[model samples]
Target: MKIDLDRSKEPSLREQICAGIAERIRSGLLQPGEQLPSVRQLAQDLGVSLMTAVQAYGLLEKRGLVESVQGRGTFVRERAIATEASGDPFGWQLAIGDYLPRASFWSQSAVRLPPEILDLATASIHHSLLPLPLLEASIQSALKQAPQSLGRYAPFQGDPEFLAVVAGYLQRQGLSLSTHQLIITNGTQQGIDLFARTFLGPNDVLAMEAPAFSGAIDAFRLSHGHIVPVPVDREGIRLEILEDLSLQMRIKAIYVVPTYQNPTGSVMSLQRRKALIDFAVAAGALILEDEPHRELTLADKGTGRLPPPLKALDPDGRVVYLKGFSKFLFPGLRLGVLAADGALYRRLLAAKSIVDLGSPLWLQKALVPFFQNPQLPRYIDRLNSILLQRSRQVADTLSRRLSPAIRWQRPQGGMHLWVTLPPFLDADSLLPEAHRRGIHFLPGSIFYPGEPESNHLRICWTNLADAELPGALECLCDVLNEAVR
Candidate 1:
């Protein structure tokens, strides 16, 4: 058999050889029961190493393309050759059967809605709030400054200039981190996934708030980590339960959204934040602090200053902080930063490299100038002002319309309000009716890792226009009233 190998191709020599043999097998050029050349002979013929030939054949065997018999030869696997003739186009899907159920549920939750419906489920702000013109100018400026960014992959850690700007920005927020301690991610979701993949393994315990972010739950689940639900109250995650769980199990990591947490807009109190850091440090466990809504906090109402982040309180290298810009800025931008120090950062960087090589360099370049500008804080303050108004509007509507039946705290900041219905009313059961009335919301059940609370739900107030809020809230109130009756 004559096999030609391209010395200068993008794929390595071993991969190329494997592809060549696999292609031949699939095309009937190498028939079933046909023996291929021995590793030594193939190595000699291709002028490659013996290990390269062995790896190629090994890859083909792993791919079910070939089988090696004792003292016989490496022959094409009959089953692999016959897969095409089997006439079942969907057979490949069987390999992913275990994952499909969870995937389906996630997709259902992410279903797109028609324009007529009021979207109270999505976490993103309306397009009108985003600085599209400013972003476009930033992109153009980035292209002019670093045109090669579009053509090449960014460093595994992130772009240096972007990282420097992010480091400076974070430093100003009371959490001082060098560029070396940071890694840019596609979003906070990717940052969560990287942390899970880096630290968690099958049956390794992961402690998170009971009603945590669904995306983080999915990420840890996919990594096969055992989830220990630590309940959260109006203040934040229950620290006593976390301490108990850590004592009982070798807790690998603790995930939290300390400030204006998703779905539930609860902020972690200063005492809890300090205690959490203490627990994590004592247990030698990492704290994956997801702070996407940190900047969206409403203006202080004589509450003094908000407590510093867990990372800020951490004297040890235990906190891995993740911050995202998508929620406040534009969802399509998909920009986020992950900060950690020493070995944890190195491990996370390695995991990130394996996940997607690196996040987009051009996007990072575009965000650098935007982030570095001194006036960015003023822009964020304006954005938060709008969000604060919307949040209060939602709280007011709920209080006026639903009254004592539905209970929720008026979020000081952030986009969502966590609402608890009367005991007899189930949020999931009410979802279809709400959707029918051109309203959409997320049931709180999806956030729980174990048994879900049926009477709880999350409503996002940032997506709808000012005029649309009252009607939507009225429709939701109608649904609740009907359910109670």
Candidate 2:
């Protein structure tokens, strides 16, 4: 008669029975080899049909966490090894082609949030951090001095003067690409979608970092592309597996976050970057270089931050460089830039037009004045300093008090450190308890598009106040301990 119930989710009768038994086992109410009710008895007891109970047993069998024997009753399986095999590394439901459920309760992540909450799920972007005032002034000036072109549709190419301004900025960064070579989009996601749709055919395999950003997965799902997951080590996307996938699976392209990768907060080393570039070139696969968290880093005890980007290293247009101001500038403004060879990009422009009439000309124009704002550099320097201090605070505090049972790596530049603890801790189960305690988290599972490990979590400290870190960590640790118990 022992059972636990799911009150909120309207699970199918089979899942309800499975949930009841799993919860009991998780809480130690059921011991190893403890007999479960016969399917008929379970169905009658739960007011469900016999078929429901049979299906429930089938699910538990598939999980390998329970046993069903002929001429005997079902029993709770041992909890050591047979219970440990389930994982969705790519976040797809079963992996061949399933959409990753976006943000769920385990995540507590929102695309946007109220102005008051400290959104540590994303990197820091203080309201006053960017050159907003100066940009506003320049926008007003542009409006006053503008000509008849305001009434006309901008060309398949982006705004002419805006393009010149961006091209000049690129020159300073050693990426010598003409304005015509670039295409402005709503944001990075649009650029990603365009790339996926244009290059990937249905069932065409695309390679991505394992447990990659969920938005990237959603883009691929939209295109119905089959994913080939490439696991990452300290250096970033493991190159040998990447090359192997390219050869064996007919990989269409490789998507990577070369600088300040999301979730893991690991950067690809220069040597790895070069090899990845060479691998892609040899395999004739395009590399999507996503550099959203650009140039944001805390100083190490002795090491300096890495300069230059993958686009800076590419001699050919084999790399499509994706950069967005939304990460550093303002998210609501929705501005992102894509740089590639003009030949490949001309077609992208037409595709863009068919998507959304070329990314809201007015909004792009409103945010364009910052390129001329000399105060821009000063603002960026200050923003980087604040983020650096916050990153250090997170690392230093965690290093001081966290238990040996938990392990973490301090990221040199990004907003978060990916953490791993004893396999018993599931971020999914701990989130509600933490939320009730006024702390929040970005669960590791949310970053993956499919099933993922239970022992990991991502903590982004960039957006929280410096004084808040100690208490938040304490609360988080308590939540973890509670969930495990």
Best by TM-score: 1
Backbone clashes, each candidate: 0, 7
State the weakest 10-residue window (summed lDDT) of model 1.
Answer: 95-104
Error of 1 at 370 (Å): 0.9
Most accurate candidate by lDDT: 1
Encode model 1's per-residue lDDT on 1-485: one tens digit a residue.
Answer: 34445576557899878865664554344557666788998898779999999999999999788998767668788754332234567634422313211221264455788888898888888888777777888899999999999899999989999999988988878888889899999999999989988889766888888788877776776675667788999889998788777667798888899898877888889988888888887898888999988778886546567799889888978899999988888899888999998998999999999999999999999998888766688778788878777777766777777857678888867788888888877787787788899999887777776456779988888888878988998898888778877
The number of residue pairs in model 1 that clash at the backbone is 0
The runs of at least 3 residues in candidate 2 whose Cα sits more than 4 Å from the true structure, single-residue gaps closed, are 1-118, 147-152, 300-307, 466-470, 481-485
Model 2 over residues 390-441: C-alpha lDDT tens digits?
A: 6666777677767767888888776677888788777756765666776777
Report every candidate's CA lDDT: 0.80, 0.70
Error of 1 at 201 (Å): 0.7
Give TM-scores for every candidate, taking all chains together and pairing residue i with residue i: 0.79, 0.75
RMSD of each: 13.6, 10.5
